[model samples]
Target: MPTIRPSGPADAAVLADIWRASVRATHDFLSEAHFTEIEALVADQYLPQAPLWVIEVDGSPAGFMGLSGAHVDALFIDPRRRAQGLGRSMIAHAARLEGKLTVDVNEQNPQAVGFYERMGFRQTGRSPQDDAGRPYPLLHMRQE
Candidate 1:
């Protein structure tokens, strides 16, 4: 059985590792530089207002999910633990929250887009780069 529990700052290192590995494995379509940037962002922001849930399988942390407001800011399952329903469970948990839940995924990440759709999210729109100059096509999906 897998258990989902709140993660604190203490879990940052392990969570960072999971985030890196998961992105590298599933996001091969992304550029190496983009991947590195994604990993760095997660490591730098995986605390405080963005709450995370560590997924433990048989007493060991195997994955994590992060939440911000009603959005699932991040969700990653250890590559080795893929296809075991952990992602679905985590998304379902997030969907149960109040208000519409939203997530922004890169346009190239079809698997993630499909996963979110299966979790009942519908494409809302697209967000281009903001004034900060960070560039990436953001596909917005929302569920109410």
Candidate 2:
């Protein structure tokens, strides 16, 4: 059975691993240095502070999403689990909680942009640099 549950301390390591694998597969725009830096933060800083939810298939972790209020701070699924509807499930879960969810998608990741569009999100704005002032651009989106 597939289930969504709140993450506990013990799930941190597995979630971090999934985050790394998911980023490696989808975020090709991240430079090596930036990837290393962000990975460190995700494991040490971001994961610890974020309100996280894990999705499991057959009681095994397949993906996670980090949320802060209505904002989707992060969403990642194990690469092996791609195209399995986990991401869409997470987004739908978020929508029910937030009423109208918001997220920032990397402009360079057309796959993600299209996925959000298909999920009923529309671009509301854009930033030339990501939150950390990295060169990577971000497209701000809100559910419409």
Best by lDDT: 2
Tell me each candidate's RMSD, in Å, in order.
Answer: 2.3, 0.9
Off-target runs (Cα >4 Å) in candidate 1 are 47-49, 129-134
Worst 10 residues of 1 by lDDT: 129-138
Tens digits of per-residue lDDT for model 2 on 1-144?
A: 579999988888899999999999999999999999999999998776677989999899999998888898888999999899999999999888888899999999898899889998999999999999999999999988
**Clashing residue pairs found in predicted model 2:** none
State in Å the error of residue 143, model 1. 1.9
Best by TM-score: 2
Supply candidate 1's per-residue lDDT for 49: 39
lDDT of 1: 0.79
Each model's lDDT: 0.79, 0.91
Task: Report how far residue 135 has shifted in candidate 2, in Å.
Answer: 0.3
Expressed as tens digits, the lDDT of each residue in 1-144 for candidate 1 is 898899877888888888888888877776677667767766886443367888899987789887887878788988899889999888777767645688888767788888888878899998775223456567898874
What candidate 2 gets wrong by more than 4 Å, as runs, is none
